[model samples]
Target: MSTFGTLYRVTTYGESHCASVGAIIDGCPPGLELSAADIQTQLSRRRPGQSNLTTPRDEKDLVQLQSGVEQGVTLGTPIGLLVRNEDQRPKDYTETDLYPRPSHADYTYLEKYGVKASSGGGRSSARETIGRVAAGAIAETYLKRAYGIEIVAFVSSVGKIHLPSSIAPPSAVPVNGADDNDDVEDSLSPEFRKLLATISRAEVDKYTTRCPHPETSERMTKRIIRAKDAQDSIGGTVTCVIRNVPAGLGEPVFDKFEAKLGHAMLSIPATKAFEIGSGFRGTEVPGSKHNDAFVRKADGRLGTATNWSGGVQGGITNGEDIYFRVGFKSPATISQAQETAQYDGTPGSLAARGRHDPCVVPRAVPIVEAMAALVVMDELLIQNARKTAAALLPAITTLPPTMVLPKGKQ
Candidate 1:
């Protein structure tokens, strides 16, 4: 249950306040360059104590590569990684012995497993994502070198504050209420589309909120600081874009591209919602307005004039840039006292202690990117294997034009 993917499998381990947390990445293609530093970039971004808005846990989160590499290149074996938990304070969580934190996994984990970690949120902690992020970085590196894929994620909203690109679809008219003359823009603004195409991780990292928009990032900072001051927490959404992905990468039916992506994103701690492309906004627009008309690219490949499908059609990729958003709930572990029940169902008040982010979206950006990379990387390998196997068969030149794929249909 700790692992993900089929061919490109990843198994994460350890818990919060444990000796270490990391992952073993299996099925990475041989000969790719890899190192602890390659994984550290994203880990550092996910680490705590980055600013006043984040927890003061003060973990270096330094990753140690344990196996699957010689010199500087991977050997196509399972890559082992570890990050020591240097700043654990188990005593701070002693109160949990009598009470389970509200809105947290404590009660549910115990109910399912019959026992729970003695300190912090245990496996539910964001610290568990360190392995995920590290594994994603490796996947990302391979994806970049092999296919020029680019994955970038940034904070789109913090509490009530949302970037202009992520605002509600005021332009959307109700499907039944709209006439032919009714104005509708079910897709993101052209400017936002441009930003999604061009925004870089460096620009996202420039702000503490991990939001590339300057004015909105400043307001998000203030909002998170307010929660930190109140000893409470806030929630928000992260938007990620994957560019330069080839077509025919996703599996249909069960393992659809967006479905796998949703599985990956929702697996992260504190995540509450996941939406791809137009998401809930598409419901308001009629099919007439929502359909993405096919267009011929300059290079003669088929392309979508409007990517309302978020680069996917029929649950498979359509060669356009894929994008999605993930929503994270407010952290359950807060310093403020809350009226809750004890382990025995007795009513009591609990004021939780220990370092926790007031808003987790900023740090969640890298995790989102990592998961996205894993999904794409895994799907890519699957698709490649299918193609390689299919290539061994004789070409069916007698098939009808409609049944057979046209030459160079990408």
Candidate 2:
């Protein structure tokens, strides 16, 4: 579905080669400060042509806020945002009219709709996600203000060039006297854990690759450049951490928090897999090693000695940092010649043309962060409504099962 989220719903419109692309965000709470600059920051990160490894197409991706805000404050109405397509090259895709690009959405779209957009695969294009990132930034901004939630995502790997073992831990390991959460986790100092684990956008944006570690980011960049030189693409992983989320944010069974998170991440263009907490690695360890022991925190709340659960258990937030990884497949469009059949099932040789990312993780970072924010924001509203209802349960107990108290009393 083009629309996402329950309470904080978003409906995206337009296509990659269309005149403009954007999203309409509904259910946004009012009275928060918002502006075009706030959404542009993330859109710039998700925009094309920012680095040597990504597409050469340079798009300003300047967002225009059409409605739902007045005097820089949201009005609790549907927010409409748009970004014009100033650099789209529909002619660059004239060749694909003959045969569907391998591993792309061309064939499936044509099969499903009996016709498909002739340029950039239409809705299949990464360009379509521009609206998502914009809407996500809004959700993230609200989350930060309302709950002090911080969502940071970075490229963890590119092709075979994984970050060194010294750096590739699933959790954010702040260093020095900074936010290294390692030591504070096992003790009663949950306050210290919060202090040490905070990561700012400045740190994440320091490198073009978005990997905070200088040495590892260089390797990832080189790997992407190498793939571009070979006319092939490489796949990689993106890790996102959401911190300062209080407990009880997801529903049981169907709307489990992590399940919704996975749904959001997989909806991205090239994302192939999603994992949270220890993910598959926990299977390699014994039960004793994998389990997170509980402790009484300095704030008089139950805290985990370790966060192997990645801040969530039973699909709900546990007040720990929620960290997860998303695996993106190599870009399907490349310049290398390949043997393929046309729509008529006849043999053909094709060399795909046009700009595409040699590695998508760097650009995917913000997109992942955006999706994560949307999920959490929706769950937060649901949980808040639950709290509102639970608070009134006692007063309504004497009424009939289907009845509700009068407005003034409630």
Candidate 3:
């Protein structure tokens, strides 16, 4: 059951301290440009030792494209990718054979599997997510090219240190600045101008940390420093928004859109909660105040005045920005010692013995975005295939006159 999605199936493999870890993506359409470089961009973001706020595990997360792609395009085959584990320290967890870390899956893994890889959390390790992120980047590229869909995620909060409302807009999109030297600078397309304006309003590049706001980034950095020094960890929420998603992307009944997204989010290490539009807050509001009002746009497109449904209705996308939030628990391996039990059920005091993060929300931002992109792209492909099949039905039943003449000539 490691595989996910009915259309775009993704199967992840390998362990945290194993020789390598990777994913195999099936159902990718042929002719889409793909390369290892595309996947690396995302792996670099989730790679450990990237910053002071995250774990200090220094691995170069270099990806190897194994199959499915030829030259630069997909061959309609399963795409295989691998990321080697260069800086593995399995010895750190060798003691786990006796002392199982509290609040970790060590005890449960042993009980369920009867046998488990003791070093690192094995399959349960966050390292396994590298494959997921890599595969997701490829899916994202296809989604963007085919549908102009975009996904962006950012750290909204870290523990009690929250960003100001004015700093980060809830659903701001990222944009690249225009170059003054370009001859086409003055003749910018309307789309480019709109993108620039959005970027300017979002202020995404104002901070070196890629945070949407400068003051918020500074405050978040300070909070991470404080938490590290106190030998504790902090957790927070990540918000993701997918724009321009087409309608009728998800299947009804068992395979709902939100359910697929939930499966992906919960797969991330430390992720504890998932919520869609309105979510828990909707319960507090009356039905009238919570419901979205449908309206027609100037372009004759259907739109919603309010997005309480989170751009999804009847378990399918409704051609709106799909927005959701995921909650991550603090890193379990903190420096502070706590009372716990050994594998033998004896009393013991345990202090985490490896390099770990004071906060994981910042790094998790990209992971969340990657998962959302993967799901949306899969759904897009499914919808497109269905449409193509329906359009070909009449043509398949009868040959065209042009085809008959050509056959006789041949």
Candidate 4:
């Protein structure tokens, strides 16, 4: 199904090479400030032709708000947003009809639909994610205001180049030989704090980008350029961390919070795998070593002695950092020619010709963060609805005789 979520639902439509692609956000809370500009900021980030590291297909990706809001505030109706395709090169894919692109959805789509769009990968294209990113930005805003939750994601690994352990891990790592100090407050001076926050905000505003640490971002950029020069594409891993998520935001049994987040991550194009908390590594350790020990704080709050669980237990947030990793496949459109089959099943060879990212991991960082924000925000809204329902139960129980009616009679 194209729709996501039960209460805070988002239904996306259109294909990559279609005239336009957009989303309808249903169940958005009324009175939330929103505008085309808010959605445009996110679209700009994921738009192509931004830098040498990404595809050279340029599009303005301007957003057109259709309905569900008035005077920049939600009207308690479905929010509809659209982004028209300004640049489309169907000629680039004319040959695709004869031979499917390697590792793309071209063959699969044809098998299902009996025909596929000749321009780009159609619905399978990363362009399909524009609607998702736009809707996610709105979800993120609500989450920040309602729960003080923050989502941060960065490219942690590209191909064989892995982020150094010194940067941190899925679980907090000891720094400067200090232990038991999970809360590492911003140690920068007031001026520096302001500078960093400004930079962080700018990154979020830019949407499809980030530079949490400028030096690191620059270094990563250089590596991507070098990889491109080799005529090869690289895959990498993105690490996302969610902080300040309140407890009881997720349901037990089926609708686990992490499961929803996993579904969202896997939905992104090129995403190959998903992992939470200790993930695969925890399987190697004994239960005693992997389990997070419980500790009671002096303020009477419960905390974990170690965060191997990554702040989640029994599929619910435990008021600690929630972190996960998403792995993306290498870009399939490398320059090197390879032996393959044509559409008629004839043996042949094809060398992809196009402008594509040498490494998608860097650009994928923001997309991962956006999806995480969307999932968390939806959960928050669901929890609020449940809370409101429970609060009214007692009042209903004490209602006057005149107000109370027999179920069948009412």
Best by TM-score: 1
Writing each residue's lDDT as its tens digit, candidate 4 over 274-367 gives 9887776555445756677788967687887666676678988888778788888998877777789998889998877666778887667667
- Local error of candidate 1 at 376, Å? 0.4
**How far out, in Å, is residue 275 in model 3?**
0.7
TM-score of each: 0.96, 0.90, 0.85, 0.85
Error at 91, model 4, angstroms: 0.7
Alpha-carbon local distance difference test for all models: 0.89, 0.85, 0.76, 0.74
Clashes of each: 0, 2, 0, 1
Question: Tens-digit lDDT track for model 1 on 111-216?
Answer: 9999999998889888889999999999999999999999999888889887774442222212344355555754667677787789899999999999888899
Note the residue pairs that clash in candidate 1: none
> Pick by lDDT: which candidate is best?
1
Q: What is the TM-score (0 to 1) of candidate 2?
A: 0.90
Off by over 4 Å in 1: 165-182, 406-410
Clashes of 3: 0
RMSD to true structure for each model, in Å: 2.3, 6.2, 10.0, 7.1
Candidate ranking (TM-score, best to worst): 1, 2, 3, 4
Off by over 4 Å in 3: 165-211, 392-410
Superposed model 4: Cα runs more than 4 Å off: 171-219, 297-300, 395-410
Question: How does residue 228 of candidate 4 score in lDDT?
Answer: 82
